[model samples]
Target chain A: MLIKYSVKTALTGLITNKSRSILTILGIVIAIAAIVLIVSIGQGAKDLILQQIQGLGSKTIVVIPGREPEGPSDFVNVFLDSLKEKDYKLLKNKNNVPGAEDIMPLVISSVKLSYFDETYQATILGGGDDEINNLMARIFDIFPDRGSFFTPQDVSSRASVIVIGDNVREELFGESINPLGEKIKINGRNFRVIGILPSKGQVSFFNFDDMVLAPYTTAQQYILGRKYFDRIIVVAKSEKVIARTVSDIEITLRSSHGITDPDKDDFFVETQADLVERVGFITNILTLFLVTIAAISLLVGGIGIMNIMLVSVTERTKEIGLRKAVGATNKDILRQFLLESVLLTAIGGIVGIALGVALSFVVSLILTYSLGLNWEFTFPLSAAALGLGVSAAVGLVFGIYPARQAAKKTPIDALRYE
Target chain B: MHLIEVKDLEKTYYIDSVQTPALRGVSFKIKEGEFVAIVGPSGSGKSTLLHVLGFLDRHTAGEYHFDGKTINDYSEEEIARVRNKEMGFIFQTFNLLPRTTVLENVKLPLLYSGVKESLWEKKARQVIDSVGLSHRLHHESSQLSGGEIQRVAIARALVNNPRIIFADEPTGNLDSKSGKVIMELIQKLNNDGHTVILITHETYTAKHAERLIRLSDGAIKEDAPVDHRLVAADHFTK
Candidate 1:
């Protein structure tokens, strides 16, 4: 009952000093807003990366033809030709690896594409006809914007046909000219353009807008003269069979390479789940760093609350005396002042959370619509709840000193205070 | 039994190892329902004695009793309880909380007294009505006139039905006209069977009580019943 009265009195005190209360609470508002915005943005970023990775089909596993590159020093393994065509054939056969639904072999290298006087350096990706049918058309939203992709007959006969990205097409042929049915030279050999790919700005560090696609057999034998595949993408038959497909590829590759020792394997396999975990780990660290910086401001805000509360107690000495003279115990005075500070911080916290959420929405909009980032709007309920709890804790921790000072006053001296 | 008893009450102040006495071995008694005035010059310790009597301060060496029970033996919490239930104070400044409604000011004491929650607002309203402030119940104390503020203080003092009301120069800050009204209100409380301990320096204000105790230099110089009560009309010309 007394607590209820104390809260009422505390509110009265705050109302009496309207501007001071607002200014005091401003500190907490900024601090809490920073916390909420940072945490929400962090959560949004993590979700965006995870969603992008999942967008490429969660049932697909990527097999890179090298040891797992742990650092920049180990990136040299990406250029090593360890996996052979026999390994791809073995992984593709359903009898040998029943868990595999389909496989697309890829070989990519930087090459210059020329159309008479106009020339542009672009990544030329070599893939089978099944790649455009399965990986490109399904995983990425890569349907031909004009003409059509090379056919299975072209892949089997090593046809000199190429499909160019929108950027490459725009560079070789002007906006008015049609690149379809035209011939482009790759490494001094002429290859007819069979398709023009739709533009995809950037995905997972690879700029699909700046690449060209050609048949793997034609690129290996006629262009680069390389016989090894760069990477293999295997789609599992079903979501439930993804783990089985990973183990099946590992077992088949292990026997195909004549490798018995697990550590000495010349290839690395990664599923969508692994990439999601890695992304989550990275975003968690970023969130923690931002929150730590935000917490410092909250601490400063708590200190401001403490300072104001102390000043309030000092200024209201006679008022304290009047209360004590009217039968208020030390505890009552203490609780009154304490309640005032806690209420201040709590109100500040609630306003901050609201402002943070609004700010997060603005930020997400800017990221998605303005910057074209794959950002999602997310309100982390746990962070909002934590903000409230931390605010109350700040009030409790910083408010106690001034409250104790208020409570310790002797009624005689306090009453005498001018 | 006497409502308040004092024996050789002494209050000494120490500042930087200097001992200055505010109350020097004084003694007094006040019976229930008595309208007693303690009149003294500045530094006479009348306020200190009242503070000690009201349990606002601890006496440094004294035997004190209220209702025949030893007051000095009670803990601070117990004294606070007694003050909440049985004692009320009116300051010279009419120390009502600023920016608060008159009714909230009167309800302040009961808020600390552990009174029934349902009785607080009703009881405060009743006391406010008694002081002819029913219309001003919602007025902020800071906005009230000196006379109205004093009346509100009186209402606050009387809200809990305290056994005794201590008015320390209740009209010290008011004009003679407002001061007279405050004095009559306090006098009316006494006439209505409430014990009143009036502390004042002004002769005219002290004259409202039936008995007067004069003090000088931290000691009681005189204590006796008044032979003739001084009237406010006759004394106001000076």
Candidate 2:
């Protein structure tokens, strides 16, 4: 019965005072829209970052040497301090682990190159033939381009043959040069380009499409004199071998380095899947922060609704009195006013949802076409329900007080009200 | 038994620091089926007395009986229930709900009484038609003329089939002809065995009542009954 009267009264009020009711509801609409839009954008950013992290490939792992702040450094540091070329001999032959079909150490350094009077600068990476083999499947997954990789003999003999990325060729050769077999000078040493690599996009601060690769022996023996490898890349045989393979690799590498403490181990082991989960975690934190701020703004909107409803009650005091005189009870008065509030909130929620979806859609489209990213638009039902439900709850909580006050008004005083 | 009886009723009004007395030791009685008019000048407390008699306002101190039950012990809800069940009220301004249609205004009491939904429209229409407002039953209060609006208020008052129809200056806003028409309508209702209690300042209006009670300075000044046999039925013929 309250709903009926409320629907009728609200409908009449909406019709009678079109501009005022719309203006009042506009505040709630904007607040809800801002809430949904901010959360959606935050969620979109999180999802995008997570997707990029996953695109690094989940089967791969990275190891970083633990930093020494309070305790003594690992044997790798001592080896670097003593300057011995024999440490490489200890690590070279230990290949038969449970999961590792191959493991290769890399030489990474920045090199400035001049090609046919054109200078292009890039990071130069060097590793064994097995290093190239490990990346073959990953490159095919993302790029699937044309070129043969390095071989065991080419790396073992310390061949001067080099592989250049597509962007480096474009930047240095420019317009008329396909320098697949051209010799490029790095630190005054000449190396012939063997194969032009396909574009592999970019990760973090480095452009994968602008790097140069050579035999690890060539880099250590000719370009840089340091014997210790800069990094190591590995590939497990299959998904089933991952867990056993990782432990076997860790144990083998630990004994080879003469380290017993896992915390004080020189190298760190991380997988691409771990990186993806970290990205997801960070996105959730960011979304949580953004939603907290939006909720505060929604609180202000609720206050606005409460204030307006109070004013409406005061302005309609005489009407209330008249109704009471005609035999309307307190409950009837409360129901009518409360219904108006719910209607206002529900309508605002719908408009806000539309705005949020539209804005997020536009951003996703721009990201996909203009920025050329694999930006995915993820819409979860939980997020939508949270947005719609909060708006309605705000309505009920803020609206009930004024409704109660309106209901409690005495018929005598209300009738006499001006 | 008297339809309404009040004795030594006192009412006080406090605006701020000063206490203004409106009804002091007022006493009056209206028998069943009596058409009584309580008259006074502006500020004479006649309206206040009528309000107390209608249960719309409570006296600060009073001994009042409706039919036979003492009203002092009733709670606000109980009083309102009694008002809904026994008394019908009409104000000078025709206090019909402004935003509602004439039909809805008349049906207001039935809604309050929790009457069956099916009988609401039937009873509302019956009373509205009986008040000769059948043509304007659906018109909004704001859209009705002064006389039409008073008729709507009367229809509302009769809709619940109350024991007494209370009118406080019911025709004060209407023209003399319309006021006379309204008074005659009240007389017809009173003759049909419903008690009618009117509070008015117009002497001409009071002449239409069978009994007159004059109030002065918050108390009853006179209680008298005038014989309508000596009064000419037609004004032009008299």
Candidate 3:
């Protein structure tokens, strides 16, 4: 028989029991939909994080005060205070690191700030004088919406002037009150708020809206009461020189800390590109895991298809006999049943792709509008293609036994079947 | 050569290693363009004889030749092709596919034949018109009467222009009046030079054909020409 008639016959067979066909394909629909949703959302998250990491500028590199962690147990080494003021001063010298544009040492700690009657717990970020502070602002792309950052004189005098984030201002001083020049108590010491940052939610793993910035000298002398630095931020002169600058900073830190062996180095440097690669790897792994979980449902769906096809073959025994008597070969019968199943799963795949995309778009909308994250709606075309292929494969894998059973029937026996 | 020749054809049914014979040492020959009826009561093995002749089942021991080729001479695929191109069937139950249009049902044989798709509708319509059912082309089988359903089956059998048609009690499911109409249609087809094989238990129905082979106890008891064969054109006014 020609393939066209076989397809038409298969279509007629499916259409005769429209409700049963729909119910049989539901498992395939749900499985494909779940796979598409997971892959799309995972792509969206990866894009958002990569975009934020890139926003930190390609020339910017972070020098964390710990060795590169090789395992879970080594994670504790990240919190060790290995970077100090002398290492910072050595990295500042042009003779020591020629490609370094600016170096800023950061000391971060969570602290409570108080006004007359209000108290708000916020992250405290302490950094160097004006030039280094400006570099930090340039990297974060954030500046004061009200007052200005502290000057060089504040670092030299250890003056207790501070820059408060937008959330701190809202908590201690309501919208009606100007928080600039207000004396906020930190660690039982009075500090004048010189700047109020604009409300920026999350950027490069930090929520700038819930932070307070001050000169590093004041934070170390009075608030934190520690002499070691937490992190050192380095800005390379250009993207082309970032690799050379990373090695330069590594060598400088090692020399200053008297570390000759490369493996014994106490500091680790990460460029923007490295962060993007790591984030992409993690998201891909997570998406693959979820897709694997969704494939289980597809297996179940294939079994459902097999079950329904067996029932259909048995129910149409008389029809099969009639067709054979009219000269349809066993191969023709097999092709007809196989085509019916493949058509069923292909339709399910199409509906699933549409449903998954719509659901992902709705979720992205909620994430963007309600939660204020930069979430983009991504359509995973490769995943859609993979879904379609897998669904068809499922049909073939599960449909063979029933189709063979149908083709194996003798015309006389089938006609005599009740 | 005879169109069909059978010698010592035997069929045995094995149920759990217990052998019960269905066709025992049957011999017959049918020429081209001849209308023959095989008559027998229930359990007389006439149905089994029809099944073996129609290639719907295999005989255990036989020398059966159809169109100059033995049953074993053709492969499975070639047998299906021969059936599609040279033979047609009409069941006692009028096995028209349910929920399908009359036109589609009539076109069923042509689907498996070597006929071109562009000519299927034209051939189907011509046969349906021969059975006087052109007006009900698009009606589904469920909407058809028993007689009309049998006519559609007849149309399907003729659609591929086969050399022989096997009608297994074609009018068995219809009323006497409808049965007369179907018999008239089958007589007209045989008169038009298509070979017809009719299976029936009634002697009156057997007399409609030119020749009769009476079967009893899995073997042929009589083979003779009908003296007073019914001429459907003279009996029924159109």
Candidate that would win on DockQ:
3
Which runs of model 2 end up more than 4 angstroms from their true locations? A67-113, A123-136, A152-166, A191-207, A212-265, A379-384, B1-7, B27-35, B53-55, B64-87, B104-127, B158-164, B187-195, B208-211, B224-226, B229-238
Runs in model 3 deviating more than 4 A are: A72-74, A93-99, A128-133, A238-240, B234-238
Off by over 4 Å in 1: A1-4, A69-79, A129-136, A139-141, A203-206, B72-76, B230-238
lDDT of each: 0.86, 0.73, 0.89
Which run of 10 residues does model 3 chain A get worst, by summed lDDT?
A128-137
| DockQ scores of all models, one per candidate | 0.67, 0.32, 0.75
Error of 1 at A268 (Å): 1.8
Task: Quote the positional error of residue A283 for candidate 2 in Å.
Answer: 2.7
TM-score of chain A of 1: 0.92
Ranking under lDDT, best-scoring first?
3, 1, 2
lDDT for each residue of candidate 1 in A255-320, tens digit (9 for 90 to 100): 999899988889989998888988898899889999999999999999999999999999999999
For model 3, residues A1-418, the per-residue Cα lDDT tens digits are 7888888898888989999999999999999999999999999999999988887777888988887888536666753788888988898999888998878888999999999889999999888664444655665788898889887778878889998888899999998988888899988999999988998888887788899988888999999999988888888899899989989888888888888999988888999888888889989999999999999999999999999999999999999888888999999889989988998888888888888888999999999999889898878898899989999888888888999999999999988888
What TM-score would candidate 1 get against the native?
A: 0.92
User: Candidate 3 overall Cα lDDT vs. reference?
Assistant: 0.89
Please, what are the lDDT tens digits per residue for candidate 2 over residues A293-322? 777877887887788889889988977776
- Alpha carbon deviation, residue A8, candidate 3 (Å): 2.8
User: Lowest lDDT 10-mer window, candidate 2 chain B?
Assistant: B229-238
Clashing pairs in model 1, backbone N/Cα/C closer than 3 A: none
Clash pairs for candidate 2? A63-A268
